[model samples]
Target: MSNSSNVTKQFSAFYLENRLYGIEVGRVQEVVRSMLMTPIPLAPDYVCGLINLRGQVATAIGLRQLFGFHSEIPQDLINIVCKVDGMLISFQVDEIGDVIEVSESEFEPTPQTISEDIRKFMQGVYKVSNSLMSAIDVDNIIKFLNNKLK
Candidate 1:
């Protein structure tokens, strides 16, 4: 028996300094614990330099830098890596959260009053339980890198 009307995509939520952030699980290649970052000279503040991720050079990006936040990043944080535009890009997040699934109708528009930094990175908001997890826009993040390189 095949049901013709039951389909839903799953999402993984991560906690970046207590705020809920969601990303499509399919986009994620792997998640690993925080590792020592080798700083690169003349690199933008956001680029924490490259890390030797199992023989692969993964560019570590500080989420804090992307947001222009002045707060200090914790000493212990992990890098979430994924293949972005054929290059391995790793994001520095506070910690990995749970994976949740919901109907397509659950996606909601982001609040207009959200901060410019947050707004720029998120596609929309996913209301999960008591908090709203901003869905990370993969394309937007890639666009940011392009703009920076220009």
Candidate 2:
């Protein structure tokens, strides 16, 4: 094992829209329950769509739809705040899992050329023990939704 891998064995993987997505333990800023969303009629369906976060309006993007999968929403829905394009945005998640530290070498590069929408949503793949967490770039997600709506 390399020096970095010697210090850790797991990392936190978050459950969003039914997919297991993980980030470095240091990336997450905060976790909040699913905020009440305001319907933006003109917005695309993938938008899921918008919510008023405190005094600022934050758009909630449906990761499931973006990935071309059925949504997991019905009961458990949560908003996970992370830096997307340097701006804090709320992501609709099913539940937030515990933090896990893992080997840095476990990360695998995403295929540059994904042939489908589902594959496009995945930024990269990071393995956690026996589980696979798809690391998504929230920034690209926002851009994709925005462009689709427009």
Judged by TM-score, which candidate is best? 1
Predicted candidate 1 versus true structure: per-residue lDDT over 1-150, tens digit per residue: 854235565677787768888778888888888877789888888898888888988888888788777777888877888888788888888888888875556677878897888788888887677777788887788788889866
Instruction: Please estimate how well model 1 matches the true structure, expressed as its whole-model Cα lDDT.
Output: 0.80
Positional deviation of 111 in candidate 1, in angstroms? 1.2
All candidates: CA RMSD in angstroms?
2.8, 3.6
Compute each candidate's TM-score over C-alphas.
Answer: 0.89, 0.75
Tens digit of per-residue lDDT, candidate 2, span 115-141: 367556666776766777777665567
Model 1 regions more than 4 Å off: 1-7
Give me the displacement of residue 93 in model 1, in angstroms: 0.5
TM for candidate 2 is 0.75
- Per-model CA lDDT versus the true structure: 0.80, 0.65
